[model samples]
Target: MISFINVDCTFGKKAGIKNVNFTINSGDFVFLTGPSGAGKSTILRLIYMDLFPEKGKVSIRNFDSSTIRNHEIPFLRRRVGMIFQDFNLLQDRDVYENVALSLYVSHYKTREIKNRVYEVLNQVGLGHRVHFYPSELSGGEQQRVAVARAIVKEPVVLLADEPTGNLDPRVSLELINLLNKINQRGTAIIVATHNYALIPRIPNARLFQMEEGEVTKIT
Candidate 1:
C-alpha cells in the first residue's frame, strides 16, 4: 500500500536516494539492507513523509507527499509506527504511560487506552513490566517497550530503522521474531538495517539492497 515513484531526495553534497522506486504491498514483510549510507533509512523517511522528495513522489494509501498539508501529517503518522536503534522510551515515565501517549494524543477513551496498552505490552512480552521505568528494564525489555509503544495504536505499517543495532545477537533474533509475528497478524513491516546476517532468519521476506543511495538489487 506504499509506493515510491522515481523518487529523488538529497542532502547537501551527500546523495540521498536517486530515482528510487519500490512498492510495499499490504501485510508484506520487507527488509532494506546495505552498507552504511545506502539510503535504507531515507526510504523509510519517505514512506512516513518525514522527508519530502525533491522530485517524484511518495504515496502511502491515499496520502501523497506531493500534496499533503502539514496539519494533516499527524493524521498520517497515526497510521504509521516507527522504532529506532536507540529505544526512545520516556525515562521519566513508566512503560504504560509511554505506550499510552500515542492513544492519548489520538484522544481515545480512557478505558480503551488502558486495554490497548495492556494488550500490546503483553504481545511484546512485557505485561509484567507495565509499571517499571526505563532504567529498571534490560536493553531487550526496553526495546520491547519501544515496540509496544509503536504498535499500541495498531498502525497500518511499522517502520524500524536499525532496530537491532543496540542489542546482542540473541536479543536481535528475538526482536525480529517478534516483528515477524506482528507482520503475520496483518500489519506490514519494513525494516531498514545493515545486518545482512539477520536477513537469513526471515527467509521469506522481500530483500532490497542499496548502494550509494540507489537500489542495486531486489530479491
Candidate 2:
C-alpha cells in the first residue's frame, strides 16, 4: 500500500534516501535496518507525509507526495499509525485520557471514543492500567500504551521508528511480539530499527538494509 519511486529526499547537506524504490504490500511486516543517519527514519517520515521527496515521489494508498495538499494530510494521518523511539505520552493525562485524546481531536462521539480506547488498551494488555499515569507504569507498559494509542484508530499501516530503543532486551522482545500480534490482525507494520538482533524474531519479514542514505540491499 506504500511505494517509493526513485525518490531522493535530502536534508542538512547529506542525509536522506536516494533513488529508493520499494513497495510495502498490505499486512506485510517490513524492517528498515541500518546504522544511524542511514535514512531509515526518513523512509517512515515519507510514508506519513511528514517529509516530501525533493526528487521523486512517495505514494501511500491514494495520497501522493507529488500532489498531496496540506489540507488532506490530517486525513492521511488518520489511516497511518506511528510509534516513536521515545514514548511521547502526556505525563499529566491518565492512560485512558492519553489514548482517547486522538479520538477527541478527531471529534469522535463521546461514547464511541470511550469504548474504542478501552478496547485498544485491552488489545495491548493495558486494560487494567487505564487509570494509571505514564510514570506509574514500567517502560514496557508505557510503550504498550503508545502502541494502543497508535492502533485505537485502526490504522491500515503502523510505522514504528526505533520502538524498542529504550527498553531492555526482554521487554524489547515482548514489544516486538505485541507488534506481531497486531500485524496478525491485518495492520501492516514498518519498523525502522538499528537493532539487528530483533529482526530475526519476526518470521518472513522483509528487510531493507540501507547505507549512506540509500537502500543497499533488500532481503
Candidate 3:
C-alpha cells in the first residue's frame, strides 16, 4: 500500500533521501534497516506524509503524497499509525487516557472509546495496568501502551521508527512479536530500526537498506 518512485528529499541544503524507490504491499511486514543517518526515518516520514518528497512521487493507498490536501491529513493519519522511537506518551495522563486520547481527538463515542481502549490494552498485555501513570510503568510497559495507542484505531498501515531503541533485548523481542501479531491480523507493518539481531528472528520480512541517502531493497 506504499510506493515511492524516483523520490528525492532535501533538508534546506543537505540531502535526506535521493533516488529512493520501493514498494510495501498490504498485509506485508517490511523492515527498513541501516546505520544511523541512513534515511530510514526519512523514508518512514514520507510514507506517513510527515515529509513530502522534493521530486518524483509517493502514494499511500490512492492518496498522492505530493499533492495531499491539508484538510485531508487527519483522515490519512487515521489509516496510518506511527510509533515514535521515543515513547511520546502524555506524561500527565494515565495509561487508559493516553491510549484513549486518540479516540477522543477523533471524537469517537465515549462508550466506544472505553471499549476500544480496553480491547487494545488487552491485546498488548497491558489490561491490568490501565490506570497506572506513565512514570509508574517500566520502559517495556510504556512501549506496549504506545503500541496499544497506535493500534486502537485499527490502522491499515503501522509504521514504527526504532521501536526497540530504548529497551532490553528481551523486551525488544516481545515488542517484535507484538508487531508480528498485528501483522497477522492483516495490517501492513513497516519497521525502521538499526537492530540487526532482531531482524533474523522475523520470517518473511523484506529488508530495505539505506546508505548515503539512497535506499536499496534486500529481500
Each candidate's lDDT (Cα)?
Answer: 0.92, 0.94, 0.91
Per-residue lDDT of model 1, residues 39-136, tens digit only: 99999998888999999989998999999999999988988999999999999999999999978888999999999999999999998999999999
Report the candidate with higher TM-score, 2 versus 3: 2
Task: Provide the lowest-lDDT 10-residue window in model 1.
Answer: 195-204
lDDT-wise, the better of 2 and 3 is 2
The top-ranked prediction according to lDDT is 2
All-Cα superposition RMSD per candidate: 0.8, 0.8, 0.9
Candidate 2 deviant stretches above 4 angstroms: none
Give the clashing residue pairs of candidate 3, or none. Answer: none
Error of 3 at 38 (Å): 0.8
Q: Cα deviation in Å at residue 167, candidate 1?
A: 0.2
* Range of the 10 consecutive residues with the lowest summed lDDT in candidate 2: 9-18
Q: Pairing residues by index, what is the TM-score of model 2?
A: 0.98
What value does the lDDT take at residue 83 in candidate 2?
A: 93
